[model samples]
Target: MVHTQEYESLLPTKNTKHSHRRRSFIIIILVTIAILLGTTLGLAYGFIYWKSRCIKTHKHVQLKHVLPGSFGIEFKLHTKNTSDTSTENDITIKWEHEPKDIRYRQKTEEMVSNDSVLTTVTIVNNNATVSYELGNETCWLNPDNSSIFEWYSILPLIMESVRSNHREDGCRERMWTTTYNGRRVFICIIDQRISYIRYDNRVAQSQEWMVPSQSSIKLPSDATKCGMMDSEMTSLLVVDDDKRQNTSDSTRQQLSYSQTYRKDNEYLKQPEIFVRSAKPDCLFIHGIGVKSPKTGYKSLKSMSYWGHIEKNTPQCSSHKFIQFNTVDNGWDSVSLHKMFCEFATGSNVDGRISNKIIFTHSMGNNIVAAALHRKVCSFDVQSSKWFSVSAPWRGSKVVLKLEDLCSGHLGPSHHKSENLLWLVLEHTKYCTHEGKMSPAYRTLHPTYKSPTGISYDDLVAVARLHVTGALCGTSPWGMGLSLSFSGTLKFIQSFSHLDQPNDGVVALNSCNVFGKKFQSIAKFALMSVNHLESSMKFGCRKPLCSWYQIL
Candidate 1:
């Protein structure tokens, strides 16, 4: 109905293609604006959400940072006040940078589990400190042998962040911004002396990052300037920060647990070197009661002595004899197992395999047996002949006597005796009336019943023989040689007379493993020899050496 300007007609031809192109361009512009607006709004909403949640109080809690190592990877702990309204039993503090769906996460899953807030959580005291260490999950090592790596070359970036915050005087200062538990607690250096950061962060959020403001500062401004040696000296002064009281059953239960294995460089000395490349003729294991250093020394000496012996053997004319330490008698059973695992399997220490030999021994033979039952490492017991010399297949009477002398301070024999007595009383009080004893205790004959089917009868028999021999001074190396042999004969006779098949000292019926299994599973034979039967007489050897015959 209105008059159009002449320029409108001249501007473009009114073709359908031109109209369609114009409409498409407009739609694209609208979509682009919508996307930009949505992105901006979402970012704003997220920032607000994070700020709102950042300062919220965890119920009945005060905050503290007890993290070890650098200030950057600060470890935090909080104390929580318990109330009837709270359902959780334990409180744990952990670090997380992103949601679980993130592609890379290096911390232990238990440290970050969402369900950590369950009813099993233990209540922490007002001054408890939480601790954690950061390690590289990506580092690889060859299990067969030691890998060469510079010990200090691999510090993490998180440690670097904390290093920047270290105070003078070698103390690490940790400060707090929020009331995490109930108190506004902070973590300072455990020891200002040896304060090289122990905790490290493996992941990086970005190529360039700013330090977080919330982390506490490390104290003693001079702490960061010391050399590596000085750092260790400073660290010696710092005590452990974990002070969670024994409030929960689980925490209390951990009292009996072993500490994690930490290697002591001073303890690692060169092992006894056997220069020979050939297989050893025989390996000997001596009994317990060794001087600590002598245990290592004798282990090495065994190789040296065996090498000399092998040179004289008929089998080797030119080949050298080599020996390796198997089970050293000095270590306790626990220490023995741990050492074997580290050296044999390279579970912790970078160890190598170098020795294989026919086995022989005294008390240590039994330890070898115990190690086999435990299957502690990659040790192979089935490949060699095991010749046991004066083996204690049963509980040792000597072990009990030595223990009684010490009033139960040392040795396996004492522990076993105590356990036996405890089991006996428990069975008498709880089981005899109902005839419903736990199979384990009943099988052990805990109540010390009559001689028939009574398990302790074997223990008693061994003890009695031990006491008899003690009066005569007649053990294997005792002063009375003839009486000792007679006692040995008596011990053997008792075993044969038992209605139950026994190991002459321990019972064979129970199938309880002996201490000789380190060599027992191998092909072995026993023989007696004495030093006097040397030098050929008309190319004929003595028919019987009296000392050897007595043996």
Candidate 2:
């Protein structure tokens, strides 16, 4: 009996051990699951937060601040809806007066699509409240839903017209127009920049314009003064007209293929081997990505067309190439405008104002267009011709991709082990994004329709010619990424949204604008030449010298 009792006790102890083991195993699995779930949720939250921050940062607007004083301001609102259905009543305007101490008078007039709804508002008291608003589903102002209360002392324009019978003496008035969302808007200023804005002749909602002035009020004449300052004391090198004509006549005949240089000429001492003309008639403007001397590349001299132009176009052999500091400072449209203004107004080598034939590549086209839009170039009587090659009239979508990649929104899947590699990739992408968002890109973006007064037809009036290359083959390396199995896969994945043929850099569809009103002189299907090669002849080991034949 004693032996049986002892054995039974041992059996119970063994059973207890088995139960303990099973419970431990269950606890470990639950803990592991909880850890995994926490990690996933954390990553998801981080991604969402980052995305929201990006959107908010991009949406925020920067407004200018103007002082509070007795001023006359006019509001001109224009709206357009491309939908078949009209959005006439969908638009609304609101205004506010601050401190409730100022008397306001307003007048509103409605006009056609191209016309503006003129509103003249007058402020009677100093330190008055002024604010303006526009409401519509689709249309807004240049800065978008922004009120000028901060920038100008005017509440909104509420007067009938400065030319009306109730005009005040010494009330200076000026008008400026801007186009936004298919709408043309005009703002007029009178004695004091104070105007009341209302929707459909309704009373404007008033708010106190109490913000402290950051700067003095800017008058219309200030703009004219600035323009004059830009043109003041400028130097120009002019080519003699008689010499220019002789150069043109002498080189009118095309050079035979045999006359072209295929290999390095031992007898040639300088990089420029072409024959020189007595005078230059054409101006050569290089495209974006043109490196400066600081970058170890001679801006214009490095270009494949540099040599070709000298060799082929006798009119350009002796011309001074316009070497813009594009690589270092970026191709800023405003700067280009000033440069063109100087060029157009400044005298040539012979101290005479002369018409020019412009040849541009890539983003150089944007500079040409901007100069024309700003009227910097006198298009009257003078026959100004423009030749654009690989013009990204609609901008490149690759910029958006590069921006995303730099922002870490797109990249190789992240792993703890590859964190260092990921950082390097991110840095490279950021540099590329910063390097490429030139002013030219901003102007070329699809959303940035040409300047208010400019059109393709207007450009064509200057006799524009466009050349684009298509049928580009797959690049071994694209935008600094290898095209191995994994790299190519990533390349495709990154640019999967692009559907048209690209010259390694720019899509064929985005290369030129085509319409009933717009057409290219010729389209070449160069299977091997990519975007850079289209304008950059020496881009490849065996340079595509043949491509320059079109010039």
Candidate 3:
């Protein structure tokens, strides 16, 4: 009995040891899991912080913020109006690199009845001093949200045109002038080379506006001028009450033609020999200012088309070209189409040649779109090629906004036309007429009807005058978004619906051709290139001399 009892005690001891071992195993597993969980949580938090920092940096880059040391150092000046004359001696600008000597200049001038003051800063390094004009109207504009501010800022070229000639005897175009924040201002942007009229009171001289460097910023192409004009200037007729009265007196003519045309009226073309060799066959249209040709040439070599309309031939030698002219900006597409079909589409004076490829630019593009939609041309759709460059198929947004403010004094069609005649008409109506643009439309229709028997290659060269200064106000994607989006969406909503290729400013998918997505094809593409680059490749820069000399 004693032996059996001892054996039982040993068995119990063994069981107790086994239980302790089991408990240790479970505890080890729990500790391992806890450590892993803590590590995972720490890693997740670190990743979140890293991602947030990256996003912040990207945002800054988009906003054009130069990273510290990117431009060597951050430099800026804070300007404030001062009335405490005694503080002038206390004013000290602690610049990182101080100017050798700094001097301030001020001028006061009267405008109509009010006096305006302009201030400038001059910095001298030894005897060489750089004079900087600060208070010029454009430079000193109150920097406000008013249209007067935005318009003058974006359309400097247009404003320059009005200022230089609008008040002269040759030019009597009415213009809108308004005072903003106690200062008078106008909206125009002409080339920097052109001279402008001085303000009635010469408080400040016009300063050379600063254009942004391409490495840091990209500006719109049309913000500056391009191309050249004819040496033998064509005259334009101006009719006004004063001229009318003078003409009725039987001593002076009712209207006299001036020997100059707006820079927009000019053209550049290739040599006659080069044109004829490319495609003895092409079609051409004439716009309002274009005169009727006496006869058609047998080939592009003998082509007598206005030099300006065919100036692009050097770059487009691979394809045949045609030209069409509209009667100024006022002629409707229907009328222009009819004239093209009857006068331009047929053979020359002897009527022996065949109709060829159709092409147009500016107002001519508008006519072509109208013509194809109306089935005015009866060519094979597959074989025919249609193209246009810098065509503002959709109207300008600025014009529509101005019309809204003027209470029906400008129409959608006024700014809607991108060509010279259209702009002139729109300006005259809003500046002189009394129409309005309501229900702002931006961008051309994304899904437009392709003209029967015509494959359209539409190209848009965006202008800075319309894009800058109002990012939030104007649509980001140029003109008509809804019209473009819905039209494009409708055209490309299904692959089963398309029949050809299409190209928008840079996005292939925006075009509606060949029943595919905007950019589904290898052969068909939509792309965007810098306007200056395009001008260089095509030799669009004027004076030909500038092409070689200026560079």
Candidate 4:
């Protein structure tokens, strides 16, 4: 190794003329070699420093406890190198990483390889190649890019349409805010040259590497946001996150969630959601099946939807389940809205809007979605926390499936399936309009971009805006209990594996309020339970004490 010496030679000044002459030829050669060496070393060091600051990333790192999934949905945030064509960063998401239910019927036809590719994208500038596994059949999200890998969803479009709305107006159309362990620590919609905070990992200013996860995380996949022809599905997460940040802006203030103290003496330990100082004023909205109940939740306790909750907390209790005058009839959005508004608007502090927590199950969520969107909103959306149980955000293609299955689509072989057919048929009949879907059902049906402007996504947004906070939670009975409604669901999922994971009643994604807006929303901890199980506690037949956990 040739080390450059900075010290001065003391004897050099006194060196003889003859000695200096002889050494001059050798000195000239050494000087020439040293110059070439120094130049080579300087260029190599500069390249290393630039790459470290711009493209450095750490993999599989731990993150702070936030939600419950404790895992992250990975997103590539590096600037594409147009000059380099390296395949070192190519990633293939495996189908097997997701565990399949044992009770799931084997679809022998759509045999998925353990290594089957899921993400669809086109690569031009040697950007990392990422693949995903979103069930059977190749998903076509952005017909132009060919896959999920190439195209970004709604936020990018909203950013494009309304560039003046954002603070980062200087950013380009493809700009992405640097996301961290499910949090946006720093948002620079410019390039990799900006600094970011990826949770515990401290990085140089230029790295755009992603952080890890905790809970409440979501990804941009067409499976969850599938066939989004409707404005609702396309814009489920389009609400600006900044509005949630402003404190003084008074039209609609967002709720901030913090851990709370639960009362042990309470009769029921309801699933935790939202951030609140005191117990909420509880309102239980039952499902379509319970619309014609013989009596209210008091009579059908623990049996009907919303029946899991107690009538009243022991004096000075946490919440009160609001009782409304009921008549036996199928659900109609207009009537339900007026009735709900009257009961909810009763003279409480601030008229009708203070410390309210609304709980809806199955079809009940459909109505709540409508009520939140209506112009004459009576129910308090600002000071309330909304819980949606088993809501179908995207419309389910259940026309033939519901009718055919009741008519022996399973061939009467399974006696267990035969018994529940009548019950299923009776419940489904109420949702049909024009021999198919009622107006509310149409909102939940797969209309995909109709001109009528009925959108479940807009429903999601309205709740986010008006309510202090909201969450959509339920157990997807992917594999149902043998002699129950889940058995019917298991049968449907058996044949329709490509529909993606669902709770037999609603697809998992439909009930989940996650994505850019919700900020990597975590998976429900109650994954072990099914749709019907929501009425009862997790792992017991008693009243529901637990449903949606942080996990």
Which candidate achieves the best TM-score against the true structure? 4
How far does residue 218 in candidate 4 sit from its true spot (Å)? 42
Residue-level lDDT of model 2, residues 159-230, one tens digit each, is: 212222222233344433333222333333333343333222232222333332212221111110000011
Models sorted by TM-score, best on top: 4, 2, 3, 1
Per-candidate clashes, comma-separated: 42, 37, 55, 23
Candidate closer to the true structure by lDDT (higher is better), 1 or 4: 4
Write down the lDDT of every candidate, Cα atoms only: 0.26, 0.36, 0.27, 0.36
Window of ten residues with lowest summed lDDT in model 3 = 467-476
lDDT tens readout by residue for model 1, 116-146 = 1111111111111111111210111001001
Clashes of 2: 37
What is the Cα-based TM-score of model 4? 0.40
TM-score (all chains, Cα) for each model: 0.24, 0.35, 0.28, 0.40
Please give, for residues 76-130, the per-residue lDDT of candidate 3 as tens digits. Answer: 2221111110001111111111222222121212111122222222111211111
Regions more than 4 Å wrong, model 4: 1-278, 293-303, 311-332, 347-352, 378-382, 406-417, 423-443, 448-453, 466-483, 495-498, 516-526, 537-551
Off by over 4 Å in 3: 1-136, 139-333, 347-355, 372-375, 381-384, 390-402, 405-551
Over the stretch 14-123, how does candidate 4's per-residue lDDT look in tens digits? 56766887799789999999998999999999999977765443211212111122121222332211121111122111111123101100011111112222233323
